[model samples]
Target: MIDYIMQYQSEIWQAIGETFVMVAISIVAAILVGLPVGTVLFLCRKGQLYENRVVFGTLNIVVNVVRSFPFLLLVVFLIPFTRFVVGTALGTLAASIPLAVMAIAYYSRLVEQSLLEVPRGVIEAATSMGASTIQLITKFLYVEARSGLMLGMTTSTISFISYSTVMGIVGGGGIGDFAIRYGYQRFETELMVVTIIIMIILVQTIQYTGSLISRMLDKR
Candidate 1:
């Protein structure tokens, strides 16, 4: 183990860095897009703030369709689109397009579910106080759902980390790619074990930190 680490320390670190970069970009993009998409979904639901059957139904269907695709297939299917957007579909940057897109759909649903946890009475009270749409969402809904939102973000982040690993199959650079190339392909069991250990550590750390924050933020 020590010898292996000494030999490939640089490569392992580079792969870790690349994985972080991809996950960071994808998560940030997903949050930016998913937050609004989810907010709109929450508002437009039947009998909610901006209730509109046509809009709500349309958005709901779209979200479901996208969410239904298997992550691997999604990556393969989006190759052309990813290529168009990023100018290539076989690297870290190009990989992020599909990762972000998938994360958006996944996280949007999480956001919607989190928002739904907010009490209707609170919304009604806010409405009765003449809270405008923006005011209601910003002040009441978001404030009430902040903890859940954080938890949702945490869950999405962890999930995307796992999904990002699959990017390695298509030349996306990351620890997963490193594991595949040197560990599995080259029959280097020690390298595979080390990468797996690193991944486990990364996931556990994120999960613990997320849970801590969620607990701290929970006013209830």
Candidate 2:
């Protein structure tokens, strides 16, 4: 294993870098796009301030459909759209299209759930104070739900890393792709074990950090 690591140190690093790139894009998509869509979903739900069954139903279906697809099939399903967006459906960058989509769907649902946990009284208090819609959400809703949101983001990011592994199917090279080519396909069992260990460590670290932060942010 050590010998293999020494021999492929550069390749391993490069693959790790590619994984970071894909995961980073997914994180950005989840934050910029997913977070807002989720906020909208929460606000537009039945009996909420912006209640609109039409809008909620449409977005709900879209989110559900995207989430329902197996990640691999989702990759295949998004080929044309990915190609159109990135000019090719192969490579680290192209893989981001589907990753972003999945991240949005997955995280939005979590975000909505997180927001649901916020105390109703907080919202009512803001309303009584004549807070505008923006003020209510930013000051009361998000402030109260920030911890849940952080934890949700942490969970989504870890899934993003896992999802990135399969992007290698479309020539999107990453640590998983390297493992496939050098470890599994090439019968380098030790190298495969090493990659698995790395992934486990990465996940454990992220989970611990997220949980710690969530606890710190929780007032109750």
Question: What are the clashing pairs of model 1?
Answer: none
What TM-score would candidate 2 get against the native? 0.97
RMSD to truth, every model: 1.1, 0.9
**Deviation in Å, model 1, residue 134 alpha carbon:** 1.5
List runs of model 1 lying over 4 Å from the truth: none
Measured by TM-score, how close is model 1 to the native structure? 0.96
lDDT of 1 at 207: 89
lDDT values, one for every candidate: 0.89, 0.93
In the range 15-75, model 1's lDDT, one tens digit per residue, is: 8888898889878877889988899999899878789999889888988988999999999
**How many backbone clashes can be found in candidate 2?**
0
